[model samples]
Structures are given as structure tokens and as C-alpha cells.
Target chain A: MGKINIIKKLSFTIVILLSSFLFIHIVNSQAELTSPTYKIVDPTVDSGGGRSESTSYSMLSSQGGALDDARLLSASYRIGSGFPNGIQANVPIFRCAESSTDSGSTNCINFPNANGAQGECGIPGCYDRFKVEINPSGNPIDTLYLVAIYNEDTNTQYFLQSDHTLDTTYDINDYMTICELEGKDTRTGSGCETGGDPNWDLSLQSSNVLNANANTNYTVKARALHGDFTESDWGSEAALTTESPTLVFDIDIGTTSAADTDGPYNISFGNLTAGVVNTPANQIWLDLGTNMQNGMTTYVKDLYTGLYNGTDTIPSQSEDLSVDAGSDGGFGLQIGSVAEDALGPLLEGTTYDLATNNIGTVTTSDTEIFSTDTLSTNVGPITNGRGGIILKALAVITTPGGVYTDTLTFTMIGNP
Target chain B: MNKFLFYTIFIFCTVFTFSNVNAQETGAVPTLFNTEPLEIPSEDNLDLIAPIVANEQINIESSIKLSPAVINLERGSSYLLKIENNTNVTKEFTIVKSAFEITSDRKLKKIDDVLEEKLVNELEESIIIEDELLVIEPYQFKNVSIEYKQPILNYLNGVIVKQRDLLENSDENQSKLDFSGQLASVIIDPTLTREQLDQLKNTITIEPEKSFFGIALNSKFKIKTNISNNSAKLLKISGDITLYDGETRIDSKSLTQNYPSYFYPNDEVSIEFDFNKDERSVFNQIGERSAVKTLKINGEVVQISDEIYVLPYKILVLLILLLSTLMITSFLGYRYYKSPKKSK
Candidate 1:
């Protein structure tokens, strides 16, 4: 009987110790999670190698917190650091916050308190969605979340937080401060804000973090935060390289309204009579397109000083022609009109307006004709900039009868 | 009826004969004006009286383009200036030559002066452009043969290729603008041998002392010199002539003889200089009274000395009077002596 009792006591003590060990393990593992796996999510793999001024990422973890724990996920991002595996030093870390009731429920959140959403709890704002399963599933449910570092497109759910939402109405100060602080909106005047309506991309902002410099490499990694505020180790890095900027320009001889790429362009003003204004049937068309940040400019020049016919000439000589066509002999070019795409308003030269009859002189030196203030938004069949050249000539009775001629050259340059 | 028919036939014959005579007279007169298009003349022909009508429209697709925007033409060599028309239409082009000068800023400035007749004539004579008017087919190029036959010196000029159009009456109230033209710089770099340069330099000569001996009897002394251009090339002579009495400078005057101031080849010009009152006083102040004329010929200073002996009209009159009195007295005395010996 004494031996049996001793055996029972030993067994009881072993069972009790095993039960305590299991309880401690369960309590400690309630809200713990592994680092999230991340990749470029917005720009698909086939789309320019996921390289852009802005970047969107999706983070996923194989496990979630226990159902009873108020668990949430968060992420931090940096540019040009954390290559291959580990994060580099001195790189700025932009922390993402959990979705709270203060922000509309449109954002993703892990577990909600009685207030229907979790607060950031003095942490940084969430980069984007931080979704977590409300009910824990033992089958390794994925805690998937989407976030954008600097997304200009408002339609996408991964847009940044400081920016105005599509449906929200924000004051001018809110828009200006955010855009200015971000250093992304290069447009001038009222175009800096695009918040109140459906056209979210009207005044889209550029990415300050991912500068998207040409021929540069960038890396991104992600980590997850549990409800207990315990953070996981950073996942492996994803790298991308940006493409070079593009600029293209061409000149064709035709009407301004409809111009083609075919060449052999020439301008002819039929026999100039005295006291009459002579204009050519066709004019030069300048076509330009570029993705350059600061836009482009075009210049024109002539081989001769004026319409020279060996012995006689109708001279312009670098002076604007503002007189009645036939009162005196003069030759010059006037800007007819400019057709531009979304990123447009191509500015005419200072002295080359057709409306004011300020015909620009074509001289032996280069003269600016058309220019733009920002990048070109041209697409297929739509030129970002189109400038027209209307050649005008006037000859008095003294203008010697002959075929006057000149050769014109156009030069285009992209702004830095 | 037979008589009336015969009269009518005779009258008709007379009328027809008179009309034929009139037509023949009209045909005999020289035709001064031409209504049709003038044919392009040869390089040697200077008769450009007829107006050339260029009727072909300028084909913009194939503009007239001259290769080697600057033409380097060496003397005594022939060069081909290629003019291209790359359009699908035939084109008529007129080539013209003009004088130009490079400014201080290295820019071309065209000079069109009717007074520069010698320059125009020299240009026409020195460079022979094979054809002044060209008719080029579509997508074809034509070569203009340029022969620098008579090179004088280095000069820069321009050859303009213009689209040609017929002179047609348009709405007088409206203005007309024609096609574009191209100007090719013609740089005439004459590579003359040393002997040739020396020969050219010696083409001008000045007659020395005897060319201006006699002078007007006045306080203003008139001086003259004969300058001759011995070469076939036209020359422009301009310089100051200084007159010196012994070693003392008397006067200086510019040679201002010709209107357009061009010395024709193989022609002699008498250039005269009239001294002012001050110059005459200076001449009188010199004691020796011998004068020296100094002028520049081909950048070299030349001096010609001449003696001055002036016979005043008053002195000549007194001398003639004295001689007449002597003759008269001698004749009277001889007559008196002979008469007395014979009769008294």
C-alpha cells in the first residue's frame, strides 16, 4: 500500500508540471507571428519590371493571432536600402499604422475593439491595409494586407493616407501643405489639388520617397506588428530598377490641324503682288513628345537673312513684322495654334503670335518658337505638343520679280 | 455684166497688192520686243534684254538644294555646283550671282549698287556659269559648270538659286509670296603664281614730267598727270598726290576724275589737280622753283621732278616793244643817210 501511494504522488506531480508547461506555451504564443513575405503588387511582373515613381506592395503571413487577442498588423518601408537580406543603416523608416475608427472603415484592419476599428495608438499612420483574420483558423490562414508608399492613382485602395480621398472634400491648405511637403506636385496654381471629385488623377503627385531616378536600383522589405505591439523580423528584400526618361521631337510640312510624319516639306508663297498679303497653302508643323520632368523647347532658324532671290529680297532680318501685309515688303513666320494632350498648354514664343499679328522673324540665328512647362502626357496617335508655322510675305511694287527662297531649320531640346 | 465683173476683179487685185506691200514693210522693221519665252543664252552672250518667263511651280517636296553650302573656287579651275530637286515634279530654277562683303562680325552683307558697274562686269567676265536657268526633272540633280576663267583677286560672293515663275498679272489689291531660295557662298581663292601677281602689279603706269608742263597764268597752279591701265583687268586707282618745291612740300590733292572711278583696261586718264591759294603761296615761298610730284602706283611711291619757268604776259609785251623800237630807229637812220648822200 505504501509503494502504490508513492507511485501515485509521483505521477500526479508529473501531470501537474506538464499541464503548467503547456499553459505557459499557449499564453506566450497567442499573438506571436513570423515576418511577412512581401512583393511589388500594383505593377504586375510583366509591367515595366514593376518599376515606377510610386510603388504598391502586398504583405502576407501564414499565421494569425488568437481569436481572443486584439491583434493588428503594420509595416515599415525604406528606399534604396535593405538589399538582398538585411536592412542598411541610416535609411529612414516610414512606419505604417493600424486602421482606426478615426479614419473611415474603408481601410483594412486586423481585430476591432468595441469601437469597430483599432487606433494607431500613437504609432505612425498605416501605409495601407493591414488585414488580419477575425477568427483564428488552425489551417494557417493568410493575414494579407496591401499598402502603397506613394500612389498617385486614387482609384487604387493602396493610396497614401495624407492625400485626400476621392470622396472627401479638403481645404486648399490641406492639399497644398501635403503636396508641398511631399515635393511631388510640380504643377503650378490651383492644379496642385485633386481631391473632391471622381477625377482623382487630375493633379496627381509624384513620389518623394522612391524618386524613380533613371537607371537606379531600389529595394523594399516588410515586417508585421502583432496586437501586443511586438514586431517581427524583416522579410527578404525585393529589388527593381527604373527605366530611362524619353523625349522625341519631329517636324513635318502640312497644316497645323492634321500633320503626318512624311517628309520633303517645303513652303511656297505664289507670286507676290504689290499691296496684297500672301500666305502659303501649307505651313510647318512641329510635333514633340517627352516624359521629361521639365518639358521641352523648340527653336527655328533660316539659312538666309530673308526671302532672297539673288538680286532682290523681301527681308525680315530678325525683326517682327507688324505692318499691313502689302504696305511694305517683309517676310516672317507666325504661330498659328498649338494642339496639346493632357499635359499641355505649349507656350508660344514671346514675339510669334498669330492673333496679335506678331510674326516672328526667321533669321540666321536660332529663335525660340514653342515650349512647355511640364512633362508631356502624349499617348498613341496623340501628340503631346503640336505647333504650327504660318509663313507670311509681303512685297511692294519694288520687290523684284523672281522666285524668292529660304531654307528653314528647327531645333528641339528637352529641359533638364 | 461682163464689164462690171472685170472691174471688180481689177479693184480686188489692186487692194490685195497694196496689202501685201504693207505687210512686207512691217516685216522689214527690226523686232525690239519678244512675246515668247527667251532662250537661255550662252555664257559669253551679254544680251540679256529679253525677260525670261519661268512658268513651272516650285515643288516643295523637292526643294532646290545646293550641295557644299560654301563653294571653294580656285582660279583657272573648273568646278561643278550640284543642284538637287528631290520632288516628284519638274522644277525651273534661276541662278543669280551677287556681290557680298563680310562684316566685322563675320556676317554676309550683300551690296547692290548700280554704280558698281565695273564690279558687275568683272564678276560676269571672271566666272562663267554654264547655265543661268535650269530645268530639273523630278528626283534628279543637275550640275552647274562654273569656270573661273579670269581670276583677279580673292573675293567672297554668293550664288542664289531661286524658283522661277512667269510674270502674270494678279489682283493688284492683293499681295503675292513666291517660293524659297538658297544662297551658296562662293569663296574665290585665286592661287596666282608669283610671276602672275607681279605682272598684275605692273599693269598700271604714270607718265612723269612732260605729262603736265603748261599751266594756267593765275594764282592757282593747275597740275595734271596721265595714268594708264595696261592690263586687261579693270582697276580702281585712288590715292593722294603731293607736290614738292625742291624739298619743301607745296600741296596735296586727291585724284577725283572719274564718276564711277573705274579705270578701264588699256585706257589712259588725265588726272588734274588745281592748287588752292595757300598751296600757291607755299610754292612761291620755295627759292629753287623746281617742283617734284609724288604719287603711289601699285602701293609704291614714285617721284617725278620738273623745272618751272613761267613767262609773264607783261614782261613779254615790254620785250616785244623794245625790239620794235630798235628796228624802227635803225630803218629810219639808214634811210636818212642814204637819201642825204644821194640828194643833199
Candidate 2:
């Protein structure tokens, strides 16, 4: 009887051990995880190695090997070696499949390793860099690495910006939402990626997204997904933000100017915060930091820009905004005067006083109405960027037939 | 009597008659033609003109010393009366022709000239006014100037007559005011019949002078200018006066009311005027001696003043006599006083 009791105890012990072993095998040990990372490590570079529409950028030192050709670094996830597979372990990845909407919802896609690659990023073996060897080793997992690309030189978002005025450091749209790589495609969280997760090939061919504005911050993290219905702690956040020596800022014509008889009224300038967090408005006020002690200048000289066909060394397009009144429609434009009740054109919205800055007089002749006059020495602070006008058109009924319109531009230089 | 002598006498008579006719046409009396026949025998070299005689020259000068100087007029022609100064000395004349007033605007610009008195030139040159007063310097002749017909639209002239003459209480002054307007009437009608124009012509009779042509040196005289409503119609008259001291002219320089003598036709008015001329004939002179050459009274007036008085050489002679008598008396007294025997 004592012998029988010993045998039974042994059987119970073996059963418990086997069951625990099965449980351990199914639950991939994932203890530490870190946030993801995405940015243009080098901000001064253009994708085509040229300063033009194709100018792209990249933050990854050796993105796609030899990071020199890259203009952007796709978002990536990483974790500590505490996970069962360690850093070299394979894992699931999710990405924003579409551009964000006004409501901030996103469509996401789950990358699968269908192309014979070990992990989720793509078929190019970028994901295979992290894996757990079959056996015969002390720890199979070497490093946890999810693949990311450095191909943002499409000139769509931030990288090779269409406007050559500024180079992009980072774009919020570049940072995509990532799921814990659930079974198949059961993404739980609602974020800036796809509203509904879709099946994506492990070796994806393209990012297929309309990127975000520059200089915006993105929140990104990663974790391990186990088949045993267990999940590791979220990985360290991908310390996103283009690795630019300077901040990547954006400007937009936030509130369009209202149509007016004389000219446009309030023209507000504000920051362009894409599907990211709600950024503050009024970028104009921010642009003109303290006081614009210097004058707001115009493009052409006061003589007659309209009369000339081409331009001199000083291109009028860069220096000035040509407000053209098509047909026989004269764009009667005049600058502001310092006189409180000046009879001159009323330019510069109420927020700004063009008179505070100097400008040319209003004219209807076949001459471009532009003035490079400087502001008064004592002109006070300039809160907003420039956009306002005063019309010198013929009286309403007396004006010739046709919808008179003008295409003007505002070239602003920071006031010292 | 021989036939040739008879023919000569007849021819001389005829020539003299024609000369008288010309003198009358010139508003001058033919005193030369009316002279008594010379008692000298006639000769072929005698020229046979009435103004010539044996070693003597007939005088030919401005006459009309008589009271009234009549001016004839015709329709559609500017009424003109050519009067000569007659005197050899420079004479200034003032002829005030009542002109219908027309409205006009005037502008003035002030000029500053440090070297000379500031003079202004009128921008507009149309000389339209209510009166056209002319000054005739010696030997110069002038026509009585009047322009445009008064539509009699305003009756302002009649009002002026009522305000002065009609309102005055003196009957003599009232009579003097009666004939004091332009004696010429205008007929402005493109559609008027010939008979109608004739009737309008008879309606205005310009019988200029009336009676008093008498004068004295340094004396006041009366010129009876008759507007004479000889046409039997009531008339309005206005007149002005101008003065001259030989060649120099004196202007009234009045901006308005240039003519103050307005009259209403109630009989007539004898307005008296005084002029003084001091005789100083000792100095050498190139022309005839006269203080005034001609006094051209015109327009609503009958006649200008006529020279009825002449200064003689008596005053110059008197001054000499008085000096001589004083000198003689002084000499006699001195001689008497100097007798030494009487004093001792």
C-alpha cells in the first residue's frame, strides 16, 4: 500500500509537470517591450540628393543599407530581451492603411509573413533580422526587430516637400498605428490608422498612405503577442520626431480671408496639425515671435510691376504677390498709410496695420501696385503674418463688365 | 452894261450862294459869305472865293454858338454827331450817352510791383456799361457813343427819375428834369411794317439845345438841355459832367452812379453849372487861349455848354498901368523930399 501510494504520487507529479510544460510552450514569455521609433535622422538631405520636388529625407543611418539614398525612415518597434523570443523573435505588426479623417479615425492593415519571410514588416528580409533559432542554443531569441523602410521621398508627406521653401524633418502621418499583432486581424484599439484592420501581406510592397504634416509628434509603442492569449508589456515608445537639427514646423492659411468690396478682410495664419493631436492655432502670431521691428517688404518696386512682362534680377514672383485682374479688370491695389484716417487703400487686416509698415499708393493704371517701403522706425509689434488688401477699382456700376479678380502673393520676411 | 460883266457878276453871286450852303451843312454860320462886298475892283488873280479878299483872310472855325445844336438820325444806323473842339488849346470833352445796362461779371488780380504802381488788366474785354462817357482832347473830335436799345425791361431809369425829380418839391427843378433823357428811340422789330418804323421814328425827336448859350469868364452858366417829349411821350433822362483844364482831363472815378442828373419829363429843368478861367495871356503859347476846348454834353441831353464869353487883354493892361502909376508917384515924392534948400 505504501508502494502504491508512492507510484500514484509520482504519476500526479509527472502529469503536473507535463501540463505546466505545455502551458509554458504555448505562452511566449514577453516581459519587456519598448516604444517604437520613426523619424528623418538627417533633416538637411533631399531624397534625390537634390533640392527639388524629389528631395527626400531619412533618419535611419543605414536604412535599406546605405541610408544616403533614403529620404525618410518608416516607423519601427523594438523590445528588451526579456520576451520569450528575445530581440531576435518574430512578431506581428499593424500599420495605418489609410489617411486619417476629420474625426481622427484610421484604417489599419495587419502584415503577414506570407512571402516566406520570418516576421511581419516585408519580404525583403528586414524582419528576418530578428528570430529565435530552432534549438541547441542557450537562448534562441537574439534581438526583437520589426522591419521599417526609409522610402518617404515620394514628395507627398514631409520628406521631399512640393514647396521648396522649407525641408521637412518629420511628419506625423509617417508614424502609423500598430496593433499587438492579434490572431489573424482582430485589432482592438481605435486609433489614427485604419478603422477596421485588414489583412496585409507580410512582405508589403508599399506604405500607401497620405502622410502627415512636418514637425508633429507621434505616440508609438510595441508589445509581444502570445498564442496562449497572453501579452507582454508594451514595448518602449518609438521616440518619434524627425532627427532634425531644427524643429520641423508647418504653416497654413488657417482661416481664409473673407471677401470684401475693397479687399480681403481677416486672413489668419495657423499651424497645420494633421491627424495628430490637436495643435494650437494662430501660427502667425507664433511666427512673428516678439516684435517685427523691421518692415514687411513687398516684391516689386513702386514704379510699375504690372507694365513689365518679365522681371529683373529680383524676380517679382519671389519678392511680390502679383494680384492680376484678368481681362480689362484692373486690380486696384494700394498699400496702407500711417495716418489714422488715411485716404489710402485699406490693406492689412485689423490685426495688422500695413501703414505700420510702408507701402505704395493705390493705382488703376497699367502698372503693378507694389511697394517695398519700410515701416516707420517706431512701428510696433507685428502679431500676424501678412495678408490684406484695399481695392482701387472703378465704382461698381461704372466698372466694365466681367468678374474682376486678382491673383496676389505675400512674401514675408521675419521682422528683426 | 457889257455882256461879260453881267456874266461875271452872276457867276460870283452863284459861287457865294454855294459857299453859304456848305457853311450851313457844317453846323457853322457863313459869316464870311455874308460879309459886305469889298469896294476894290475885281481881277482875274482874285481867286473869286468868298473866303478871300484884298489882303484879308476870311475866318473859318467851329460855329454853332447859337443855343440849340440839332442832330438828325436814321433807322438802323448808329446815331453819330461829329463835333470839333474849335479852340486851338487842348480841350477835354465828356459825352455821356445813356447806355442800357447789361449784366456782367468782373475779376481782379492784385499785383505787386516794387518799382511801379500796381496796374491791373481786366481779363474780359467787353466794354458794356450803362454809360459811355468820352473825353475829347484839343483838336480831337468825337461822335456821341450809345449802344444797344433798352428793352425798358427794368424801368430802373423811370424809378430814378421818380426818386429825384418827381419827389422834389420845386416846380423849377421839376421843369429842369422834364427834358433829361436820350432823345433817340430805337425800333427793334424784324417784323415791323415800314409805316410802323416811321411812326417809331417820329416818336423820338432829338432837339438837343434849348436857350441859354450866354456865359462869362469865371462865371456860372445854365444849359437848358431839353429831352422835350416833343413826341408827346413821357421820358426818362440821365446825364453826367466831365471837367478839363486845357489839356489835362479830370475823371470822376466813380464805380457806380456815374450820372446823377436823372430827370422826369414835366416841362423842363435848367441845371446851372459854373466854370472859372483866369486870364494870363503874357506867356508865349502855341494855340488859341481857352481853359476848355469843348464841353460835349450828350445823350439824354440837348446840348453841351457853348463858349458865350471871351477873356480880353484888359487885365494884363491894367496890371501894367497900376505898376507905372506907383513908380511915378514914388519918384515925385522922392524928388520933393530931396530938395536940400527946403530942409536947411
Candidate 3:
């Protein structure tokens, strides 16, 4: 029993030692990371409009403290994906003060606490969230990086200017920023950050400026400045793209390089039955693309020919021939939809779906077109950069046919 | 459990919260001044012609004239000299630059110590003197924009132009024309103030100010400049800023970056460059820290506006501790709320 008592006492001593060590560890750990821990949870910056002034964006720190102010250490816009350190160091670094309290006000961030729903620094009276500004690149910046460092002033920040942060060492419980050789004014925003926001991007309004155009795609990335020498991990990347890729859009008549002005868009549907429709001569290629995502469309109209006999004009009731753009790459033009574009006199009961009769298949609509900057456009029944339209003349069994012809206008209208 | 968790969170806020600071440096380095996004000029418009007229001494019977009968130029600047072709016919004129002989007479003009010199030698070493004959098209003039990349010996210079017509592409027979020895004298003058080029000075004005240069800390300074463009078209211009310590020239930075900026007419742009001495500092260190008495910017129109200040390290030490204590307490209270038993 006496031996048992000794063991018990030893166990108790070990427990006490462990507790003391853990308590010290918690305190020490806090101090080590106390040099303003932060993250640009979302570092993807998107410049809505291409301007020459400071473009703004904000990110509230998730768990760390407040960033009273941040100096723009460096910001550069480079082409391709790789970034060179200080490549654009010559560009002016604009100041972006923390906007933890009011969205509109530049003042108000001072504390470091996380509340239930609101971030201690992300919301009110805290430095967890920072409002950053990008200085003038002057040129249109579509794909680039913006590095900003958070400035910490222990005196102005936490009222510890008396604490010589750089030259002196403090206990784990202290709350002073240890900048270079100064007291409370610790400068932590001087490091070079190479790993950027993978999704960093910028899209310009016009191609004339900085080679940015409606078809261009840009990426943007950023990171938060940490300790007097540390930098937080890069945040998420922002993308700047409005149009679908030029490769996704495809159109082919008989040839891929034909244009609307070419005479290759002609289709002739032989005699049609009262209840049976004849096949089309040829089908127009298509990939009716998505809106702005793909691009705009243009339909060029040359002329419309009314169906006529060698001598007499056909009656309006007998005009039953019609044609329009195909629905898919394989299908020809829809021969006789009720609303189909047409000009002729024939039986009222005859209609043709280009795919079924096979005179000419109606592929998808030509929504996939190119922007105006494209040089030497392709000429085809359907072209991504340039395009043309083809029409076929169809006739009913009772209708008179002397080779009635009508011109189909191919039009391309772009997205806003 | 709730009590422990709440206390833990509260402790987290107290021990692990708040601000981080950044670093910066400044000192005047030759800075490149860039223009804000202004209107882009038409393709037809070009930079200053140095002379307003295409030809100054054209014979009444001749169809060409060198714009400025007499020319004055600055060092390390790009100049656009025009060879005018006034005739309606599509004519091509070939200029022999080797034939550009310097006159024996030396004239004197003084604007600065660096700009005082003789005229004859300036002509012989003129950067604008090309090796081949320059061609000028009909009705449209051609300009030779020579950019002097090196420092030049200050002097006044003179050159008389001689030309021949290229008869290859034209059907007109080669006619004997004595277009030689016309006095198109150039005064390769760097003196821009008293002797004026009204075409540029009257159209563009640049006012520069050195806001401040730091002493002990990492070198830093702000160059605040206002460039006013009064002409009709946008200006695509690049300039350099330099630092000088009493007569010793320090360093220079080419404002060639962010090139071809559009400077619209009637626009005044405010440019502030907060520069720091890292590798780009123009001034050498006095004792690990660079000190300078005068800062010079030689780009655009040179007018110096200087501001200097030293940092105050004393007040930074004597902080109102009570005021700081009060503010810190208030902020800490707001950051760490009383965690209820239910918050776990």
C-alpha cells in the first residue's frame, strides 16, 4: 500500500508537469504567430472596367488579427503565366488601408477578435480585413500580379510604440509589432512573393489598348503580407474572360473557308408532294454557340427572289418553298417550317425538314462567330471568323416550277 | 465544455490578435514619368518637328525646303527633322548624309556649364548624321527621328544638305537640279531656355517637385510632377529623371516603360513617384545612407520643385501611454466578447 501511494504521487507529479508545459506552449505558440497572421482568402482581383486609377478589392482575414495599413510593395502585369520578381517594380504601388468597419470609409480597423458570424477583424474595429488598391499600370492590365504588404504600427496599432520590436525580444504575452530596427513601427511588407494567384486575371474593354480585346482572357493573383519578413500564402485567382474560346466555334459548308458572298450556298429541292416533302440539295454547317460567351452573329442579305414561271408569276397561295439555317452539324436546313424563310407558290400542305428529305441538311444555328479584329476571315457556309448562308428552292406537286430562286441573307450580330 | 471553449476563444483573441506593418524606401533615381490614359492621337500626327515649317529656305522654283533653316538641339533627346516634298508629282529625293560637311566657323552659346561650346565640332560629331542618303516621298514629308543614346559635347553646329532624285520608280526623266549648298544650318544647341523651340515649350509644360528624401532609414523620396499638354493631338512621350550631388551626376532611370502613353491635348497629369533606394537609387550612400543637396530631373521641360524633410524618431518614443492604454483597452474589449455557456 505504501508503494502504491508513492506511485500515485509520481503519477500526480507527472500530470502537473504536463499541464504546466501545455499552458506554456499555448502562450508561446500565440506569441510566435502573433506577428499579424493573415490570408487573402480570395486573392482573385477583377478590374470591372479598364481604368487608369486605383482599382479596389477587399478580403477579411478569417482567424488572424487586424492589418491597420498595407503598403503596395510592388504590382506588375506580365504576359503568359510565369512571373518575374520585381518585373514591374517600377509601377507605382498604391496604398490600400484596411476597411474593416465601413465599406466607404478608409478609417476604423484596430482590433483582432473573431465574433460569432462577423470576423473580429473582418467586420468591425479590427485589422483582419484589408481594402487594397492597385496603382496605375497605365497600360491595360489583363493578366497580372499585385503584391501588397500590411503595415503594422504597434503604438498606433495596439499602443505599444514604447516596445522596441526590432532590437528587443518580448515575452509570449506581448502584443507589439517587431519591425526592422524600430519600436512599434514594424515593417513586414517588404518580401518578394513569386507564387501568385493561379486564377489572377484582367480583361480589357478593347483590343486596341494593351492588345486586350473581346476575345482575350486574363488572370489575377495576390497574397497578404505577414511578419516583418513573412508573406501569407497566395489567395484564389480571378478570371477575366467574357467570350467563349475561338476554337469551340466551327462551321463548314462544302468547304471551311467559304464566305457569304460565295455562290456555294445554293440548294435546290426537287418537286414536292402534297403530303410528301423532297430532300434538300445540301446542308449548311453549324454550331449555334452560346451568347457573349461564344460571340455575336451577322446575317448578310443580298436579295429575295419571288417564285415565277417562265412567263407568269405564281399566286401567293401557291408559294410554298422555304429554307433556313440548319440545326446541327449533320442535319441540313429545315425545308418547310411554318415560319421558315421562303418565297414561292405551291401546295399549302407540303413542308420539309432538311434532315428527313436530305436535299440539304440544316445544321445548328451559326451563333459561333468571330470578333471584328480577325484578319482575313474564312469563307464558308458557316465560319467562326467569317461565314455565308445557302438557300434551296423547293416546289410542290401542283406548283409550277421554272427554277424559282430566292436569295438568303446571312447575318452576324455580336454580343454587347 | 462550453465554459472551457469560451475561455479558450477569449484567450485566443487576447494573446493572438492585431496589426502587421510594411517597409518602403525612397530617394530620387532617374524616374520615368508616364501619362494617364488620354486620347490616342491619329496615326498621321507625329512628335514635335523641332521647326514649324517643313522647309525654311526653299527656292521659289524648288519643291523642297528643310523646315528649320537654322536648328538647335539638346543632348540625349530624340529629334524629328523633316525633309519636305511640296510638288504634286510623285517624286523621290535621296539625301547624301556623307556630303554633310561642317563649316569652319565656331559660334558660342551658353545655357549651362555643360552646354557651352564651339559650333563646328558639334556638326562633325552630330548624332543625326546618318551614313546613307535619306529618301523623301512626294507631297508628304519624311522626318529623321535621331535618338542620342550617349552624352554629347556641348556646342553649336552647322550642316548644309545636298540631295539627288531616285529615278527608278518614276517615269519622269532625270532633270539636272542644283539643290546643293542650301544653308540648312543646325546649331546643335543644348541651351533650351533663352533660345526657344516654341513648338514644344509653348505646347507642353512640366513642373517637378521632390517631395522628400529620407536620411537614416532605407532611402526614399517622392517626385511630384505636373505635365500639361496644350497642343491639338495626344502625346506619346518618355522622359528620364536624374539625381545630382552638387556637380557630380548620380544615376538615371529611363521612363521608357509603359511606353507610348496617350497624353491628350489640354490635359495636365499629376505624377508622384515614391522612390526608395534599393538597387534603383540614383544617389550613392554618404555613410551607408545617401545624402543629397540638389535633385535634378532632365526629362521634359526642366523646372525643379523640391521638398525635403527628416524623420522624427523622438516623438515616436514619447508616446502618451495613458491614451494608448485607454485605446488598447477599448479595442481589446470589442475584440474579445464574453463567451456564454451556449457558445461552444
* Reference-based TM-score of each model: 0.33, 0.15, 0.21
Residue range A1-416, candidate 1, lDDT tens digits: 89867766765665556556545543432322334874321111110111112157322111111111122222322122011111111211122112222233212222222211122110111111221111111101122111222222322212212222211122222212222323222233323234542322322222222222232333333333222222234433333233222333444666555755333346567677775657777877765544333444556667566788768768874343456544557778888888764344577877686554446677766566776653355211112467787887777777778767776755443332
Comparing 1 with 3 on TM-score, the higher-scoring candidate is 1
How do the candidates rank by TM-score, highest first? 1, 3, 2
- True-structure RMSD, every candidate: 47.8, 64.6, 30.7
Prediction 3 global C-alpha lDDT:
0.28
lDDT head-to-head 1 vs 3, winner:
1
Q: Which stretches of candidate 2 lie over 4 Å from their true place?
A: A1-92, A95-147, A150-256, A260-352, A355-386, A391-416, B1-344
Candidate 1 segments whose C-alpha is farther than 4 A from its true place: A1-210, A217-219, A224-229, A232-241, A317-328, A356-358, A374-383, B1-344
Q: Score the docking of each candidate (DockQ).
A: 0.01, 0.00, 0.01
Which digits, one per residue and each the tens of the lDDT, describe model 2 over residues A301-366?
Answer: 222222121231111121112232221212123333222111111123222233321223321111
Error of 2 at A63 (Å): 37
Report the Cα interface RMSD of each model, rounded to 1 decimal.
47.6, 68.9, 30.0
Give the proportion of true interface contacts each model preserves, from 0 to 1: 0.02, 0.00, 0.00
Top-lDDT candidate index: 1
Q: Please state the CAPRI-style docking class of candidate 2.
A: incorrect
* Candidate 3, A1-416: lDDT as tens digits: 99867766765665566556656655443342122665322122111111112247332211111111122112322111101111222222222222222223332122122221012111111111122233222312222323322122222111111111111122222221111111111112322111132221111000101211222233322332323322223432322221211111222334332312111223444443333433443444332221121122322212212334345332222122332122111112232321101111111111122233333321111111122211233111111222222333333345543544333323222211
